[model samples]
Target: MGDVFAAVPGAVVDETGLQHLGNPLAEQRRLAAGTALAPRADRAVIAVPGEDRLTWLDSLSSQALARLQPGVGTELLILDPQGHVEHAASVLDDGETTWLIADRADVEGLYDWLRKMRFRLRVDPRIADEFAVIGGTAGALAGVAPASPAGLPLVWTDPWPDVSPGGWAYAPVDPHPGADRDWSEAIVTRDEEARIADAAARGDLQLAGLAAVDALRVAAWRPRWSADVDERALPHELDWLRTAVHLDKGCYRGQETIAKVHNLGHPPRRLVALQLDGSGSVLPDHGAAVRVGDDEVGAVTSAALHYEEGPIALAIVRRSTPIDAALTVETADGPVAAAQEVVVPPDAGRTANVPRIPRLGRRQASQ
Candidate 1:
């Protein structure tokens, strides 16, 4: 069970005083307002443009970018020579330049890598935090236009509105009315704090704590780098080939390795969903063993008690494990039956007929 919302006179407080509820009525007002907005965390934006921008980027990532249109975005995987995923990002193009938004932790590494690879390319890659991103399901953003919500640049709207199914939009925060009034950002100025507190009292948007956000993401099967990937993971192994890899794309640093595994061999492992049986102890953290009988087949990468699906997890299991079979996930306490819910269908697995870049080298060693 999670912590309860304590009703404290005019204010709402949790057991921990750290979160001082400003006003119950106002919070309730915002909840009733029902304007859905979710924060996009662990993302950094890198802007790139120049005479050689497209070719430079295309030569680096696992996706084909020669055809990426303006006002659209595509997911890409940056890989090491060994084909291990170094980082992943959502790349957006404005026709003139491309912006790469990746996990916050990987931004530095990515920036450094891009800098090193800037040889003779007329592209510039730099971190820009002036833009803030807020998103929500399409239905919630139905009425909002591409214009700035308040005064911030509505730089762009979700081009593939139907891709996420439920839909979502990312907009800057400054122009968003009352968005700056919360203690969410770490570097808010004193003057901004009072203004934001006042805005909070006026019943603007409901602030969803990180816990609620985490639960929502897990339910959506949205993979997170911290929970779902590591240095040992390959782009294909994370079930990102469809979204991250461009099968027909030309040569890149790791293209040979990627094409080899994708077209000619099975990836070492496959990412799958694990539905925990029964109301067990809180799902174990990442790296807990997943066993088929007594033999360990894989480990849990992410786990949570979904609001709709009870206990569920995402794990990278051995490719040999039967897709339709049931397995046991080993928690600290003991083994618990976890039924496999295949997210990346087996047919889409690496063994399938993934288009290859002709005459690539042989497959790399499996993990």
Candidate 2:
């Protein structure tokens, strides 16, 4: 069934379906304008069924899923004890089942972890092989109905850059870049996948690729699990607290660290959008060194050429790196000069104001 996309004309299929037709920039414009659909063959789906699903997931992850109403789209992150992001999932519930769309590379590990955590719960978490995903803006997807098993469409809308209920925002920018992003993903059956592919093959529907999706995502300052995350990633570091993390939610695995960091300290690193010098016509590869003079400050996580933004990238840099600092990205071709646009600022956390308690017994005399 996946090979159906490979038959579509001009598709550059690798292991993932439809990398791009040819021009990613033009494809990005088409995708953003709702004229094209991108086959998200690079994603995996997981289904959790049973009456206990919502509360069970709410107890385990960062989002407030306990009272999740049907057909509402949200996201969650599974964090290690020290609060490093372990897994992330885009979530949508159809009243009877909770559907999770995750990156393909992390599916097996996330599924295994979910199985291990279902000790006494009635929920059955399974890797849903029968479901696949297609992505576009809500308008682009309106013509195509998502799979509705329990009278609700199984579509996961991205809530990026919005402060969800109980979530916090650290980025101080007015009119956030993601405010204009209207991306969503629909869960479809194998038959539906074939139907879409057939439409593309007949030139009845326009098809974009994952590359175009990435370009638009990067332009919107959207952080993707597959591209923006690393071993030491924290939700605050990526401005993911704007959507993914519920700072006031009940205690979960990483709640302690999440609270402490947001209230008392700063994230060690911060996310930045880099406007690369397009005169060289070279986009830095993933993992390319991001440097300020001789000091390598960080690494490029994702890079792309947008329809309007020319060359751009998202990189993780030390929180102390000056926001106004001019940066350079070391690419295989040469060093590309980059101007930093702050996403997560250096003072991203420390929301709480806790007064000192006179340093135990030593400071009483000073008054």
Best-fitting candidate, measured by lDDT? 2
Candidate 1: residue 252 Cα off by (Å): 0.8
> What residue pairs clash in candidate 2, if any at all?
none
In candidate 2, how many Å is residue 115 off? Answer: 0.1
- Residues 1-367 of candidate 2 have per-residue lDDT tens digits of 3467988888899887689987888888899999999999889899999999999999999999999999899999999999999999999999999999999989889999999999998999999978889999999998776899999888889988777998887666666667789999999998998899999999999989999999989877888888989889998899898788888778899999898888889999999888887776778889999998999999999998878867888999998899767688998788978877778778777663322221112111112
- Which 10 residues in a row give candidate 1 its minimum summed lDDT? 358-367
The candidate that wins on TM-score is 2
The list of candidate 2 runs beyond 4 A from truth reads: 350-367
Q: Candidate 1 lDDT, tens digit per residue, 1-367?
A: 1122222223333432213244322332232244433333444567777768877788888877776766555667788888888877777676676777666778888888889899877888887664333334443334233222233323333222122211111211112112212211121122432343344346553443334445545544556666788777876665555456676778887878877776676677777767787556567778999888888998998876544455777888887788656688878778788877554444444345433222211111000
